[model samples]
Target: MKTNVKTSPILHLTYAAVCLALCMVLPFLTGQIPQVGSALCPMHIPVLLAGFLCGPWWALAVGAVAPLLRFALFGMPPLFPTGAAMCFELAAYGLVSGILYRKLPKKVLNVYVALIAAMLAGRVIWGIVMVVLMGLNGSAFTWAAFMAGAFVNAVPGIIVHIILIPIIVLALRKAGLAD
Candidate 1:
């Protein structure tokens, strides 16, 4: 027999809340190690997971709020460029990932494809936001800087995401928590 379970509003809200908490805590936990936090990108993981699990709008809400919340609570990311850029970047990640996951066939390969696409889209959005914000501040953001920060500096996080997200999602599927 096939069972169709529609996600309830309470469940969606709970999941989004949990993922938002994770997004906030992960970065703070990782930030203890100085540059390692930036390299590992702990904040991105939860947003990505939320995108896969909670759908696009929930994911977008988490992504858009995480950075600003963190800045307000901890004052770590500052309120200006970094936090602002991250807001757009993570919203792109959540939006693209959730949409693609829902649209694509249910397969491990499709998840990976969706994830990579989300990563690229998020980075592009980040670059654009950075350029505009920096330009307004009389600073320049070049392609090389974007490449270095988005790709080079984030290699470890990318690798972690590529390896880990699929594992988690597949496990959730096997356990019947993911559809």
Candidate 2:
């Protein structure tokens, strides 16, 4: 008799939980700098990976909750403003990635296109919301800054997510853990 070679859903949940916990710990890490600040947060890796692997609801939950928990635990994001912004932005990363991934065909090109598109859209939305909430009418948001911060600055995190997520997803798929 051969045992099934599939991972359990409970295992995936455990993996997601660990990733969320790691995300919550990132702001406390020592390499954080004042110039980039949370703009270059590494927490996004796991959350985005979670969305890619687990689906939208899980990704949304992790993205929505990570900022609040990180602020509460690490105390770097303060309470009201930046934390709120991240709640929207990171949640958008998760939600959009999951939705786009699902809607498009399962190809590497589709995956990358969806990921990059979601990243751009999510950053723009975050910036727009910030401008409105802060009432910075005259001051302009630099799209260059947005691209630099959201993509260029996050290259390492992006590579990490790109490499790790697919492997994890494949493992889960092989193990029959994914839905």
Clashes per model (N, Cα, C within 3 A): 0, 2
lDDT of 1 by residue, 1-179 (tens): 64345376666678789989998788767777876677888889999998888899999999999999988988968878999999999999999999999999998899999999999999999999999999999999998999998999999899989998889888988898876
lDDT per prediction? 0.89, 0.69
Best by lDDT: 1
Q: List the residue pairs that clash in candidate 1.
A: none
Enumerate residue pairs that collide in model 2.
6-175, 7-175
Tens-place lDDT per residue, model 2, 30-136, is: 25666554544677777776766656777888888888888877675665556777788878888888788778877766667667665666677777666664554
Following a full C-alpha superposition, what root-mean-square deviation does model 2 have from the true structure? Answer: 4.5
